[model samples]
Target: MQALTRPYGALHCRVDGPSDAPAVIFANSLGTDLRLWDPVLPLLPHTLRYIRYDKQGHGLSTLGGGTDISDHADDAIALIESLADKPVFFVGLSIGGLIAQTVASRRPDLVRAVVLSNTAARLGTVESWQARIEAVVGHGLEHIADAVMERWFAPAFRAKPELALWRNMLTRTPAAGYIAACRALSKADQSAATAALRLPALAIAGDTDGASPAELVEATAALIPGATFHIVPGTGHLPCVENPTAYAAILSPFLKAHAHD
Candidate 1:
């Protein structure tokens, strides 16, 4: 485990693969930790050093205050710049995707390429996000856990016993962390910046994803020039968990192609 301490708090991260390998960092969705990419790491090209971390307020990381997507992006950039020996390939999902974009735009030299999964430049209406924040603050994470689960996993996947693990993870997430992230999302609208990025990029969508539908994910891809887009059939928002093979099939080639570019 590798850790980086910031003025506000510290981030807990894990790195695997050869030390001399190219770096590929993954940022997970809201309510999930670095483990979100566990299924996909083993399937990635062994030539890459895969890195995953628990962002602020999730997993083992501290829940800091007064941060937006850019600050989250900076934390990722700081982690990579301090640890990685070379430029990194970044992959992010949902809110993580927003952070990925901010990273690319603000620090293009540190990033070689990026893959945006199940996310968009702009999410739901601000009012809807505020309602969600209020619900979580007023009631508890349990209040919105089920509805979020519906957006996260397909019905078939939900029926399986494995869903309980994710549900537990969701409900266990710190309320302050979840609410702060929601407020950040409510204010995020990265259309122009995302559209302006010039890099190797791919956008992934789960066919059954309700939160970030295929069209929404594709739209983000369309923002970047030469970006490739794909859809993972049968999976929902968090496709990396449901079908790691499918997610890796698309990502491995991108990493290989852009490893040196």
Candidate 2:
């Protein structure tokens, strides 16, 4: 529950494990805060230091007029610089994935590798994002919370009683903040930049993901020279939440392999 001051505003951050351990930084999805990685954190290796933070306009962080994915990446860059003294393994989900790619592209010295989960280089079209923005602005987040839940998890998970928690989180998100992130997604295209990366990369996707399907994630992985792609069965966009065990299984080995790099 720490906050790091940035040019736009302060970013709420949380760190776990040994202070001097190899660092792993997580950037969460849109609409969700740093808590998005809570389920998966305990499952990761104890030897690593894990860092998670709320992006501008999400969680307790302020928006301060950030309008693009790069703006979000700037916060990530600042966080990494302020905390970790060495390069880190960056794992990002959905919109966070876009931010990871941008950070890796711009500041390779700060990143050792990247794990992209349930996301693509380019997400929705401008018109589609504009429509979503209009819906949230005109009707509020509750209007689209149901649909977002469907995209977030598999039907089996949704049938469980715990589904209510995520739905509530989505609907409670600040309208202005969520819309600002939507505008970022609408304009972000990291295909070329991601392809240029030479660092170790892993892209994981849920087989049943509605937002960024397995095919889309695999295609994005293909852009990178040697990025490994994995598909977690029975999960949707947020596998780390739906089945943190399986997600951690896929992620743990990557962390081990790149721990010394």
Candidate 3:
């Protein structure tokens, strides 16, 4: 684990692989930390450097209250800029995808390419996000973690041992942080920004993902010219954990093909 002070707050990050290798940064979804990427990292070839960091309020990172996606994107760019001069392959899931899109749009020079997984350009109805915020703040993370876990994984995967582990992690996250993220997602609208991105991009979705349905993923892919779209079989929102091998099979090629040399 490594720590860095960015403009927004202190960021806790995990660096893997060779320092000199082409950089690939993985951003975690709302309510989860960089640990979510643990299963996918080992499957990736060692030729590239990997950076996984907790978003503000998610893991070890801390920030002032009411941080939005744009703020989060700035934090991400700051972290990457502090680490490497080279552009990086930005891999993001769910809310992370929203941040990646924001970064690519505002600071295209920092992004070599993007891998957006199990995410949407615009997530949830306003009412839904509001309800989510209320639920988390009123009841706590554990109150909604079970439902979140169900949405995160397919029915079959819910019975797996790792599902329990993920649930525990989700349940223990700070309710304030989770609610803050819900508000961020509530207001985030990247449709115009994402459509303008000309960088090489890949959008991966799970066939069973209720949060980001295949159609929505397909629509998002269509917005970006030449964006490759792949649907992971028998998985839900968190395909990186639900089906790590298959997720890697799709992601490794995307990373290799567009890696900054």
CA lDDT of each prediction against the hidden true structure: 0.89, 0.93, 0.87
- Tell me the alpha-carbon RMSD of every candidate: 1.0, 0.7, 1.2
Tens-digit per-residue lDDT, 136-203, candidate 3:
77888878888888789999999878788888888877677778888889999999999999989999
Best by TM-score: 2
Candidate 1 vs candidate 3: the lDDT winner is 1
Off by over 4 Å in 1: none
CA RMSD (A), model 2? 0.7
Say which candidate scores most in lDDT: 2
Q: What is the descending lDDT order?
A: 2, 1, 3
Model 2 lDDT on a 0 to 1 scale: 0.93
Model 2 C-alpha lDDT per residue in residues 1-261, reported as the tens digit of each score: 799998777889998889888899999898998889889888999999999998888888888665798899999999999889899999999999999999999999999999999999999799999999999989999999999998999999999998998888888778899999999999999999998999999999998898999999999999999899999999999999999999999999999999997
Model 3 clashing residue pairs (backbone): none
**Local error of candidate 2 at 76, Å?**
0.2
TM match of model 1 to true structure: 0.98
